[model samples]
Target: MLLDHGERILTASEAIFRGTGTKLSGKVAGIHWHYGTRSHAPELTAGYYNTRFRDGYLPIASMFARHGVIFNFTCIEMKDWEQPGDAQCSPEKLIKQVILATRKAGVPLAGENALPRFDQDAHNQIIRNANLRLPEDSGNTTVEPMCAFTYLRMSQHLFHPENWRLFVSFVRKLAQGQATSNSWEQEHRDTDKFVHAGGPMVQEAAALLH
Candidate 1:
């Protein structure tokens, strides 16, 4: 959810949790640089970080804790500062800013991916390790799996009625508790009654769109 210095966001989140009958698993709080771009001024960035933590983050965190919601806070680095109209700053500096603020606020840090070239396996490991140590060092560690997609593409064929039919049928079967097997092939058969490597998976995704 978007961070705001208002009570409405908290109340609305609670309402949604109750209404859906879905258990609240975890919360991912994201902090972004001002105006969607990195700030070059050190003092400005520091002030913004301190103010946001005190006014925006802390109270909401308290509310969630009162409601028994486990969460982790994260920051999004604007890696595209190399592009036009963006303020350029080092990824290391941006990361430091976030960690320091969350540390002071006594909130657990959430794992995040930013900075294009720094998303490699080694860098990811560093993030995971740091999060794991949070509980030991600060006694505040509630990290959740953060899924980052580097590649995703949508096929136009999914809009076709024929394609959507097969996809929907597969999902319907699953919703009816048909796919009990753990194996992919067996589950697909139980869900869709067919499995073809050429692209049954793609078709199944389209079918559910209807």
Candidate 2:
């Protein structure tokens, strides 16, 4: 069913472009998939992974690539489970699977946060994922960085004084370059301390400058 939906979208897009006499060469079209991890019992993880990827994403991936559809995925900020017992279906593992699939299909990739978050940790995770810095992808130059990244949603909380400050810093870091894991950790620590020490008034005043 999902595959059929994807095909219909591609077909409709082609038709629209043809009817409007618009060339599709430079046009961008994408399909967004929400990343999901099965954290069930370890015994069931393999089956779930195969069903979700092999049957679900893998088949549609090639189809999308053939139509020049970008694979824009979400939930990039999820962390891996530390417990060995729960490692089979960790977010890291699931995200890696998606990355490999997209790379194999020769599709351009993009990402989005799963939720609206203003913390440095979440932003750093998004940066790492977007840069394809996963341990397995390290030194693998063939893997490309995300073509783009979208923050999940805009909400009242996002505009709060402290949140706004952190958000500005996050944007700056992203623009700078690909950050190493150590740099992300240091930034997380510094941001935590700063947020704790800053008062509401100070944060509001600081936000006004940016």
Candidate 3:
């Protein structure tokens, strides 16, 4: 909705939550922001992290919390306070920025990646080792496992450094293997269907909590 409407999903959510009366957000909740390139183009531009955030700001975070919207931005970064331009954002810096922004906006945040997952023991352990009871309002503070920890770790590996070399290597390999394999038409359709079906895996991953 935020993407289609171009702004204000968060504010509206808060109003809805307040009107409906629900507790804000959740302990295991998380958000992801995609940065860098979406495709190969003469000019590389536009992505979740690079996209302007001032448009919606914290209304989404705040509203989601007020109404118990657990996770958010399934594929966008929470962003941080820095330069107005997207060039300044990095994965680590963005993480810090999100932590600050979410806190200020009154919703604690985390870097969440979907499963077939990664080990989040570091993130969870920090909270657990502290042995915190749930926040009076929050119910649970544990960063419960959404799936195997490897997915999260792998996601970090894929995006944290913005693995340009890996991407380059892939392109080089594809270019070298430029011969298109002739496949039956039905085979192509079947492959497309299987690829599109990964969406269900993602939803199932989100539903998983340990």
Best by lDDT: 2
| Candidate with the larger lDDT of 1 and 3 | 1
lDDT of 3 by residue, 40-107 (tens): 12112232222333422255455545545543322121223422454433343334334434544665
The whole-model lDDT of each prediction reads 0.41, 0.62, 0.35
lDDT rank order: 2, 1, 3
How does model 1 fare in lDDT? Answer: 0.41
- Displacement of residue 42 (Cα, Å) in model 3 is 15
lDDT of model 1, residue 113? 35
TM-score of 1: 0.36
Residue 3 deviation, candidate 3, in Å?
7.5
Which scores greater on lDDT, model 2 or model 3?
2
